[model samples]
Target: MSLYKTEAIVLKYYELKEADKIIVLYTRQHGKVQAVANGARKTKSRLAGSVELFTYSDFLLYQGKSLSTISQTEIINSFASLRDDLFKMAYASYVVEVVNEFTVDEEKNEPLFALLLATLYMLDRGEELELATRFFELRLLNLLGYRPQLDACVDCDLDLAKIDKVKFSSKLGGVVCADCALEDQYAMRINKGTVATMERLLEIDYKKLDRLKVPESTRQQLAKILPNYLQSIIEKKLKSLDFLKTLTMTN
Candidate 1:
């Protein structure tokens, strides 16, 4: 059996027979990986902490025909805060879910791995959840080649800044000007502020996200549009998304 090592973040996991677990992780070198952690469910298992959701860790694995086996693991960051706070956990979970849904197994995407780590760190530090989410959404889309045109009309070259009204069409994959609204009759009217907020989130460094204050209105608008836009890409809603909505609605 060949052995390998990688730095990975635990995306999710499932229980196995007795004291084992089947873990799903997104690695820096190898994109998404699924491995079995023998005895991980035991009290004294070293792999226990590393298998928790969102834990960043170094993994030693024995390659298997069906699924690799996690031979060893060392925790880099448990991201305790995300687990301690329900809201924060929900946000972090959503980002990881996005990563899992958009990526395939063993396809290397270091940028995406870094983005997930950064987003998790932001949530752990108690930063702006909505802004962080928007940044992750836009950046993730861009990295995956589904980048939506936020600068101008998706149909024409009409400058959005000079326009008084704009509409976002998931079908067209960007914002369309008023004149082009007829192109996608289902396009939803969008506010300039929301568009600008999305633009800033896409352009600004995530570290300086705090400097840009996002109004509740913009957040609400994003809550409506961005998630729907993202869901439109996948066609089926993510299970984590429904949980997130339930959490938000209850609180």
Candidate 2:
């Protein structure tokens, strides 16, 4: 058919019949793309390095009837450091997994693409990995139109700053004031500190994540809350998250 080129980060890959591999990528221009890397499993295959998970690369693709084929590739940033550390790799995998699971083929989302790239860069460079992951989750939710309302009650629309006790309702999708909590029986009590942390994380730039200190209690609160929020949004448990929890517990 036709040939095209674009910048992409390899999300994941699976072995194909014989020496080929099926690569899932999130491209800067094309959103998510699935393509075949012919003979990629073979030792001498040119696509081997370019198609590895988390590798940012430029690719030449051949448009086919059912799937695109990666004809040529050049490495941009392999994010080599992620491979050197188990924890970093696990976090990175969770990031990519979120991108891969939530996105649809060829759905162009530049902000999402940028967020993923920036997050990977932070992970690779050894920045605040935990904060970065939380920030990414919050931002990703906003970008995808699932942003939780933190400033006010989801039901009554009252400003949370004026409210003394605020409860977070994952079912209602945001903070609920004391009066509104009765309406949402499943609302869980959220400490003011964790609420503040979430608000700050949502507003701060990704570049400054390392500068934002999260107290152990706040971090634990976030570690509990954000994943539950994300799981509620996605409606299923993330496999990578299970592995990440295992890694965290072991370490």
Candidate 3:
């Protein structure tokens, strides 16, 4: 066994026993980590607050052959505001869930780690949640090597400006030019503003997301297009998405 320290954000957790918990963390130095946090369920336990979902903290761990043990923890940013509001909680949950789905254990993903931290901070501080999430999704896809082709047709080399029509093809991993529409018959029809929004999202800093105003029509298009593209990549619908859908219905 070896001892090491890292900063991580709680992704999710489960009760391991009466008092212990299994915490899923996305670490800065280590990608995704699961370790036992003993006595975390107890009200008096020091690990209680630090292990809560979305808490960014410093940890001292003992790496074991089969699993790691969280020996100590200190909260860096609790981001408690996200848990206090249902609307914020729901959208942020979807964001973290996407990160959890796309990553594997023990991989060092510094860029993704920074991106997620920025996103959670944005959510916590009450930035425009919808636009923040859209930015997070686009940036996350880029970090995971799944950046969709927006500059030209995924099926053909043609520049999209020349084409009067463009359709988003998740299978082809980008927009298909008008000439290549038949490539994916189920391809999503996209408009100029929507395409421009996505392109801008790809390039903009997540912190400056507020500066880019997204019209409701474009937001609706993004709501449809991005998730469909992600579903194609991941091959399964995220559970958190269903939760978001339910929230929308009740509102």
* TM-score of structure candidate 1: 0.94
- Scored by lDDT, model 3 comes in at 0.89
Error of 1 at 202 (Å): 1.2
In Å, residue 53's CA in model 1 sits off its true spot by 0.5
Backbone clashes, each candidate: 0, 0, 0
Q: Each prediction's TM-score against the native?
A: 0.94, 0.94, 0.96
Cα miss at 78, model 3 (Å)? 0.7
List candidate 2 stretches off by more than 4 Å: 182-186
After superposition on all CA atoms, how large is the RMSD of candidate 2?
1.5
Per-residue alpha-carbon lDDT of candidate 2 for residues 147-196, written as tens digits (9 for 90 to 100): 99988888889988888888888888899989888886767788888888
Pairs that collide, model 1: none
In the order shown, the candidates' Cα RMSDs to the true structure are 1.5, 1.5, 1.3
* Tens-digit per-residue lDDT, 107-202, candidate 1: 999999998999998889988886788899999998899888888998897888876788898888999988888888888888889898887887
Residue clash pairs of candidate 2: none
